[model samples]
Structures are given as structure tokens and as C-alpha cells.
Target: MKLVLTQFKIELLRIFRNPYYVFWSLAMPIVFYFIFTRVISTGATDAVAWNKHYLMSMTSFSVMGSAIMTLGIRLVQERSQGWSTFMRITPLPGAIFFLGKMFGQMIMHLSSIICIFLAGYLISGVTMPVHLWIYCGLWILIASLPFLAVGTLVGCMKRVDTASGVSNALYLVMAILGGMWMPIDILPKLMQAIGKWLPSYRFGNGAWELVQGNPPKWEDILVLAGYFIVFMLISLYTRRRQEAI
Candidate 1:
């Protein structure tokens, strides 16, 4: 337990030391929240609704960025530097190392969520019951599981450069296609259909539903769980292959 805690602390320290991670996971989303909800859509009648909606969307975006892009690239870099191999040979338990990375990523994920929510409240005048706010945050965190699994899979498969490229591609594509940049109602019919099938869409949709006083559809939860399982299997396979080599 102590070793795992120590490793978790080290992992968090490493993440905080990285300027790119700090900026993307914390600063960038807040900036976007202000730009979109504050500057661009000033004096809107549905300010509260729009603020809450965009808050959820931006939280999803930031969580995806951290879970997939940041975590994936860092894992690839570690593997490329032979750090993964060194860890395998060390007395550190594999579970501890894995937990350390996961916990570190979750910390970043939570930070992003809080920052976006804060921007929504302070800048956009978003107001909600305290319990609703807590529930919405929890839902967003739950929705991040599949993306985190995907990140682990990406981390296990690609070289650093390839991982970076793939992560960026996935991040942008998912964000747009999933309607994070705009509402699905405003998108083309075909695009809306495609977005409905995406994990990102399901994630944001679930959070949006919760914020709008509706229960999240079971279908969305099932789809995310399915994706999570598939990605976990792929990650396990890749790890086994690496171990064999």
C-alpha cells in the first residue's frame, strides 16, 4: 500500500512537471469555456442552460484529452525510454505501477472537470442545485472509463511519434463528430447519425441528460462498457506480447 502510494505520488509529480500536460489538462479548457460561453454568446436568454450544457461538453473534451492523448503519449514515451522494462525488472509490483498511472490520470481528469465547472459558474453564470452539480461531475467521471481504456491500448501499441499523431487525430475527430464543438441538432443529419454511434457522443450525451433532469439511457452506458471491455482486451494482448519479447 505504501509503495503504491509512493508510486502514485511520483506519477503525479511527473505529470505536474510537464508543461504540456498542465496547459492542456487545466488551462486550455478554461480558456475555451470563457471564449465560447462568455465572449461569443454573451447576453443569451438561456445563459444558464447553455452554460451547463457547454460545461458538460468541455468537461468531456478535457477528460478525453487527458485520458487518451496525455496518458497515451506519456506511456509511449516511457516505453520508448525503456522505463517500462526497468519497472518490470524492479521489485515494484505490476499492479502498483498500473494503479499509479491510472490514479495520476484520474487526478488530471478531475482537475479538468472542476476547472470547466468553475468557469461555467463564475464566467457563464451557471447555477444548479448542489446535489445536481455533484451528480453531474460523477457522471462525467464514469463516462471517461472507455477513453481511459483506449488510452491504455494506445499506450501499449505505438511508438511515441505514432502515438502522438494517433491521439491527436482521435481527439479532434471524436470531439467534432461527437458534437462537442456544436450541438448535434445543428449538424448535418448524416453527421448526427454518426455522432450517435461514437463513444464520445455517448459520454457527453449522458452528462447532458443528467444536467437536463433526465436519466441517462442504459444504451449509452452499455455501449461505453462494451468499448471499455474491447479496449482493455487489446491493452492486455499488447502487454502480453511485449512481455513475451
Candidate 2:
């Protein structure tokens, strides 16, 4: 148990020390939110709904970037560099590898929440419900599992460069198509239809629902949960095959 914790601690420290991780998980979201939200208020460009809407959407978008893209790419890179291979041979438990990745992703996401809160309160002047915060936090964590599984799969399946490239492009494209960067209502009808099929879109919309005081979304949650199981199973199956090879 202590050994697992130690491994997690080491990974956490390493994640924090990496500029790419820190910037993407910490600084980049703020920059995106601050600049775009501020620009939306200028009246030259129209926004989705209002200040609160911008707050909700941008926050969700940023969370996706941190947990999905930043963490995903890094994990893939680590795997490519023989990190996972060496760790696989270590006496340290395998669960530690997954757990450490989880902690790092979660910590990075905490930075997103802080920045969003700051943007909401300071810039947008939006007030949130106590229950809503709880809802978002729980749902966000739940949604993260699929992406975590994806990160693991990408790292396990491909070379680091390939995984990193694919993960980043996937995240960015999804962010745009999912209405994380723009309003889905304004997008082409085809884009709106396609976006619905994306996990990121569902994630952003789920978060948006809570902030908008919509009814609890059991269906969406279930979809994300299902994805988590499916992704994990696939990644695990593939890893076992690789080991055999």
C-alpha cells in the first residue's frame, strides 16, 4: 500500500514539474477562458446565450482539455519512453500505475475548476448552486474515467509520438465540434448531429445541463460510464495481447 502511494507521489511530482502538463492543465485553460469570454462581452461577436452560459461552456471545455488531452498525451508519452514497460517489470503493483495516472489527472482538473470558478465569479458574476457544484464535480470525475482509459489505451497501443499526435488532435477537434469552443446552435446542422455522437459533446452538455438547472441526466451519465468500461476492457485486452507478443 505504501509502495503504491510512493509511486503515485513520484508521478504526481513529475506531472507537476512538466511545463507542458502545468501549462495545459493550469495556464492554457485560463488563457482560453479569459480571452474568449472577455471578447464575447465586447458585443462585436455574439455568444452562446449570456455571460453565465459562456461560463458554463468554457468551464466544461477546459475540464475536457485537462483530463482528456493533457493527461492522455502525457501518459502515452510515458508509456512510449519504456516507463510502463519498466514499471510492468517492477515489484511495485500494477494498480499503482493506474492510480498514479488518476491522481495526476484529477489534480490537473482541480486547477481547471479553480480557474473556472475565478472566471465565473470575477468576470462573469455568475452564482452557482451548492448542489450543482457537487453534481458537476461528481459527473466530471465520472466522465474522466473513459478518457483515462483512452489515455492508457493510446499509450499501450501505439508509439508515444503517434499516441500524442492522435490524442491531441482528437481532443481539439472534439472540443470544437462539441460546442466547447462555439455554440452548437450556430454550427452547421451536420456538425450538430455528429457532435451528439461524441463523448466530449455529451460531457460538455452534461455539465451545461447542471449549470442550467436542467433535470439530472442519468442517461448521459450511463453512457459515459459504459464508455469507461468499454475503453478499459479494450485497453486491458490489448495490453495482455502485447505482453504475449
Candidate 3:
């Protein structure tokens, strides 16, 4: 128990201290939100609706980046620095180590969600029922699991440089295709078709629906779960292969 707590604390500190995590995961989303909603005003007819909808989009975007980029790169660096090997020889159980890291990531996700939510309220005067706020936050956090699995898969790469590049590519592609950058309704027909099938789109769709008083579609939950399973299986397989080398 103590070991898990200590490990969680260390992970938290490491995540927050990483400049990449701070800028990309935390700051960048808020900046983008401001730019889209405030600066390059589309003169949205329903400004409040667009503001609220985009809030969910940017929040999902931020959490996804944190899950796929920060966690993935850190795992690669740990392997290179011998941290993973050192931990293997320690008293820490493998499951506990994984749990600690996950809990830490969840904390980071929650913090990012709260910060972006606050920005929405303060800057754009976005408002919603208290229950809606809680639901949206929970939905975003839970929906991030598949991305975390993706990070794990990316972490399996041998080189940190390779992992970083791949993770960035995946992150940006998912964000754009998932409708996190703009509403899928406005995207080209082909992109809309592609985005609907993506986990990122499913992830954001849940929150967008929630804020509008609609329940998230069952397909969103099921698709994300399926992706999570597939990614985790592949990551496990890759890790085992690496270990056999």
C-alpha cells in the first residue's frame, strides 16, 4: 500500500515536471479554446452553444494528449534509463506498479479537466447544471483508457525518439479526425465518416451529448472498450516479445 502511494506521488511529480506535459496537455488546449472561441470568431450565431461544445472538445483533446504522449514517452524513457529493469527487481509487484501509474495519470487527467472547465466558465461564461459538469468530467476521464492503452503500445518501441514521433503523429491525427479540433458536422464528408469510427470521436461525442441533455450512445462506450482491449493485448504482446529478446 505504501509502495503504491509512493509510486503514485513520484509519477505525479514526474508528469507535472515534464515540460511537454505542461505545455501540450495543460496549456495548449486552453490556448486553442481561447483562439477558436474568442480570437478567430466565426461569429457563431449561438455563441454560447459553440463555446460549450468546444469546451468539451478541447478538454477531450487535452486529456488525450496527456494519455498518449506523456505516458508513452515516459515509459520509453524508463526503459532506456533502466528504471523499468530496476523496478522489476524491487519488492513492488507488477500489478501495483501499473496501478500506481494509472492512478497518477487519472489525477493528471482530472486536474486538466478541471482547469479547462474553469477556463470555460471564467472566460466564456459557460454554464451548465452541476450534474452535467460532473458527468462530462467523468466521461472524459473514463474515455481516456483506450488512449492510455495506445500510449502503452507506443511505449513498446525500442527508441524514445521513435516513440515520441509516433505518439505525436497519433495524437494529432486522432485529435483532428476525432472532431476534437472542430465539429464533425462541419468537416468534409469523408472525414466525418472516418471520424465517427474513431475512439477519439467516440470519446468526445459522449461529452457533447451530455451537455445537451442527451445520454451518450451505447456504441460510444462499446467501441472505446473494444479499442482498449485490442490496444492492451497488442501492447502486452509487444512487451513480451521485447523481453524475450
Candidate 4:
């Protein structure tokens, strides 16, 4: 237990030390929220609804980005630099290491959710009931598990540069296609169909519905769960293959 706690602390410190966590996870989303809500569509019809909707969008966006880009790239670096091998040889139990890292990243995701929610409240004057706020935040954090699995899969890459590029591209493509950047309704009909199936869109859709006093659809929950199972299976396969080399 003590070793797990220590490893958790180390993971938190390591994550905070990465400038990308601050810039990409924290700062960029807030800036995008400000620009989209304040600058681009200051005159949006039903400004309150737009603000709330976009708040959920950006919060989901930040958490997803951190899960894929931050976690994935870091894992690749550790493996390439032989840190993963060193850890494997340590006395620390594998489950303990996994728990610590996963819990630490959960903290990171929670922080991003809080910061973006704060920006929505302070900067955009978006208001919601306390329960609704808590519900939406919790939903985003929970729905982000599949993306973390994607990160683990990306971690299987042997090269940091390759992982970095792949993760970045994956992050951007998912964000854009999933309707995190803009409303899926405005996109072409074909694109809208595709976005609805994407885990990213399903991720934000649940939170968006929550803020609007609707429960997330069963389809959304099922889709996310399916992706989580598939990604974790693939990640496990890749990791075992790497170990055999």
C-alpha cells in the first residue's frame, strides 16, 4: 500500500512536470471555449444553451486529449528509454504500479474537468444546478476510460516519435470527427452519421444530454463500453508481443 501511494505521488509529479499537460490539457481548452463562445458566436441564439453545450464539449475535449496524447506519449517514452524494463525488474507489484498510474491519470482528468467547468462559469457565465454540474463532470470522467485504453495501445509503439505522431493525429482526428470542435448538426449528413458512432461524440453526447436534463442514451453507453473492451484487448495483445521480443 505504501509503495502504491509513493508511485501514485511520483506519477502525479511526473504528469505535472510535462508542459504539454498544462498547455494542451488545461490552457488550450479554456482558450477555445473563450473564442468559440465569446468571439465567434457572441450572438448565438439561446446563448445560455449554447454556452452550456459547449462547456461539456470542451471538457470532454480536454480530458480525451490528455488521455490519448499525454498518457500515450509518456508510455512510449518510458518504454523506449528502458524505464518500463527497469520498473518490471523492481520489487513493486505489477498491479500496484498499474493502480497507481491509473489513479494518477484519473486525478489529471478530474483537474481538467474542474478547470474547464470553472472557465464556463466565470468566463461565460454559464450556470447549472449543483447536481447537474456534478453529474456532467462525473460522466465525462467515467466515459474517458476508452480513450485511456487507446493511450495504452499507443504506448505499445517502440519509438517515442512514432507514438507522438500517431497519438497526436488520432487525437485531432477524433476531436474533429466526433463533433467536439463544433456541432454535429451543422456537419454534412454523412459526417453526422459517422460522428454519432464515434466514441468521442458519444462521450460528449452523454454530458450534453445531462446538462439538458436528459439521461444519456443506452446506445451511447453501449458504444463506449464496446470500444473500451476492444481497445483493452488489442492493447494487451500488443504489450505481450513486445514482451516476447
Candidate 5:
């Protein structure tokens, strides 16, 4: 238990010291929210409604960005530094090591969510039932699992530079297609069709539904679960291969 806690703290320290992670995970999303919600108004009938919608979208975006991009890059760097190899030979269990990483990522994810939510409430004047806020936040965290899994897979398989390039490309493509940056309805018909199947779209959709006082669609939940399973399988396979080598 003490070792796990120590590993978790070390991971947290590493993340906090990385200016790139701090800026992208904590600052960028909040900035985007202000630009979209305040500078460029949607002019909807209910200001709160527009803010609420963007809140969910931005939250989804932030969660995906941190879970996939940051985590993937960090994992690749650790591997390149031979940290993974060292850990493998240590007395520490693999589960505990990964769990510590997950805990650190969870902290990043929750912090991103909170910052965006605060921006929505304070700057954009978003108002909702307290329970709705809690529900939406929980859904955002839950929906991030697939992306986290994908990050782990990418980290396990790619070198640091390659992982960074791939993760960034995936992040931008998913965000654009998933209606995180803009609404899917405005996109070309083909793109909208493609967006419907991406995990990022499903994630944002679930959060949006929750904000609208509706239950999340089971299809979205199931799709994300499927993605998580597939990514986990690939990650495990990659790890096993690396161990054998």
C-alpha cells in the first residue's frame, strides 16, 4: 500500500512539473470555452442552454485530450527512459504500478472537468440543478475510460516521438469529428455519419444527454465499453510481447 501511494505521488509530481501537460490539460480547454461561449455567442433562446451544451462538449474534449494524449506521451517517454523495464524487474506488482498511473491520470481528468465547469458557471452563466452537475461530471469521467485504454495501447506500442505524433493526430481528428469543437449537424453528411461511430462522439453525446435532463443512451455506453475492451486487449498483447523480447 505504501509503495502504491509513493508511486502515485511520484506520478503526480511528474505530471505537475510538466508545463506542457499543465497547459494542455488545465488551461487550453478553459480558454476555448470562454472563446466559444462568451466571445462568440450561439444566440440561443436560453443562454444557459447554450452554455450547458458547450460545457458538456468542452468537458468531453478536455477529458479525451488528457486521457489519450497526455497519458500516451507520458507512457512512451517512460518506456523510452527504460522506466517500464526497471519496474518490470522490481518487487512491485505490475497492477500496482499501473494503478498508480491511473490514479494520477484520474486526478488530471477530474481537475480538467472542474475547471471547465467553473468556467461555465462563472463566466458563461450556466445554471443547472446541483444533481445534474454531479451527474454530468460523473458521466464525463466514466466516458473517458476508452480513451485512457487507447492511450495505454499507444504508449505500449510506439516510441516517444511516434506516439506523440499519432496521439495528437488522433486527438484533433476525434475532436473535430465528434462535435467537440463544433456541432455535428453543421458538418457534411458523410462526416456526421463517421462521427456517430467514434468513441469521442458517443462520450460527448452521453454528457449532453445528461445535461438535457435525459438518461444516457445505452448504445453510447455499450460502444464505449467495446472500445475499452478492444484497446485493453491490444495494450496487454503489446506489453506481453515487450516482456518476451
Candidate 6:
């Protein structure tokens, strides 16, 4: 437990040291949210309908993108430097390393949520059910874990450049099809059908529901849990094979 916390602290410092995150992770979504709010708030009804759900979902996208893409790229870079191999030979338990990373991803989502909530509160008078905010925030974090695990497999299990290329390309494809760029309503039926399969789709919908003061349906949790299990198994199997080699 102590080792895990230590690793998590170190990983978090590395993430913050990037500096670029202050804009992309912290400020960009707030800017986008207010811009969208301004465009949509042309009337009284629109204002009435306006709340944190829309903004929160946007934050969710920001978290999903950052956790999957940024973390994925970092994982590959670290692996390429033989960091994973070195860790494997060290006193650090491999599970602790993965857990620390997963916790860092969760912390990233929490930070995004806080920034967006503050932006919405200050500018739009957007309010939320406090308990639901906590609830929904947790689900958003839960939904992201599998994608982080996916990054673990791709970045650590394969060549760094290939993993980076594949992860980014796949993120873009999933973002469009999964309605991260826009509401799923605007997507084609076939695309929406496919969105059901992508982790981000459920994340968006679950976040939307949470902001609306609704508990997530069981299936949202189920889908994310399933992905977590599947991806972790893949990563674990590959790690064992690498050891065998």
C-alpha cells in the first residue's frame, strides 16, 4: 500500500510537470463549455434547460481523451526507454505500478471535473446535486480505467511508435463514432450502433445522466467492468508471454 501511494505520487508529479496540461486539460474544456453555452443560450428556454450535464459530459470527453491518449503515449515512451523492464526487475511490484497509473488517471478525471464545475458555476449559474456529482464523478472515473488498461497493453506490450500511432488513430475514430465530438443524436444509426460497443459512448451517456441527478443504470457499470476485466487479462497474458520469451 505504501509503495503504491509512493508510485502514485511520483507519477502524478510527472503528469503535472508536463505544463501543457494546464491548458489542454484544465482550461480548454472550460473555454469550450462557455462558448457552447453562449451559442446555445440565445433564449429563455435554452437557459432553463442549461445545466451541468452538458458541460459535465464535455469534461468527461476531456478526461477520456487525456487518459487514453496522453497516458497511452506516455506508456509507450516509458516502455521504449526500458522503464517497464527495469521496474520488472526492481523491488516495485508490477501490480502496484499499474494501480498507481490507474489512480493517476482517476485523479486526472477528478481534476477535469473540478475545473469544469467551477467554470459552469461562475459563468452560467449551473448547479448540481452534490451527492450526484460525487456519484457521477466516480462512474466517469470507473469508465476510464479500461481505456487506461488498453493503453497499458498497447504501449507496454508492443513497439512504442506503433502503439502511439495506433492508439491516437483509434482514439480519433472512437471519439467521432462514440459522440465525443458531438451528441450521439447527430450520428448515423449505424454509427450509433457501433457507439454502443465503444467505452466512451457509455461514459458520455452516464455522465449526462449523472448531471441530471440520475443514478447510472446497471449496464453502464457492467460495460465498464467488462472492459476492465478483458483488457487487464490481455495485458497480463502478454506480460506473461514476454517473461516466457
> For candidate 5, lDDT tens digit of each residue in 1-245?
79988989998998778888768876787888899888986666777777888889988998899899888888898889988879989999999999999999998888788888988889878988999999999999888999999999878755788898899999999999999998888899999999999999999999989988999999899999999999999998888887796
Q: Per-residue lDDT for 59 in model 2?
A: 67
Q: Per-residue lDDT tens digits of candidate 6, residues 1-245?
A: 78877999998988878876777677777777777676654344455344565666667767876777777777878777888789989998877998888777778778887777777788778876687667766777667887777776775545667876887787778767877666777789998988877777777778777766677767777887788899889988887786797
- Backbone Cα, N, C clashes tallied per candidate: 0, 0, 0, 0, 0, 0
Q: Is candidate 3 or candidate 6 better by lDDT?
A: 3
In order, what lDDT does every prediction score? 0.86, 0.71, 0.91, 0.91, 0.89, 0.75
For TM-score, candidate 2 versus 3, the one ahead is: 3
Q: After superposition, how far is residue 14 of candidate 3 from its true place, in Å?
A: 2.0
Candidates sorted on TM-score, descending: 4, 3, 5, 1, 2, 6
Candidate 1 positional error at 61, Å = 0.4
How far out, in Å, is residue 164 in model 6? 2.6
Worst 10 residues of 2 by lDDT: 40-49
Error of 3 at 212 (Å): 0.5
Q: Give the poorly placed runs of model 3, Cα more than 4 Å off.
A: none
State the lDDT of candidate 4 residue by residue for 193-232, as single tens digits: 8888999999999999998999999999999999999999
User: For this target, which candidate reaches the highest TM-score against the unseen true structure?
Assistant: 4
Candidate 4 Cα errors over 4 Å, as ranges:
none
lDDT of 5 at 241: 89
Instruction: Rank the candidate models, highest lDDT first.
Output: 3, 4, 5, 1, 6, 2
User: Residue 85 in candidate 3 has what lDDT?
Assistant: 97
Query: Which is superior by TM-score, 2 or 4?
Result: 4
Which digits, one per residue and each the tens of the lDDT, describe model 3 over residues 108-134? 999999999999998789999999999
Worst 10 residues of 6 by lDDT: 41-50
lDDT tens digits, residue span 59-121, model 1 = 898898899988898889888998888998999988999999999888877877887788788
Model 5, backbone clash pairs (residues 3+ apart or across chains), number: 0
Model 2 misplaced regions, further than 4 Å: 41-49
- Off-target runs (Cα >4 Å) in candidate 5 are 43-45
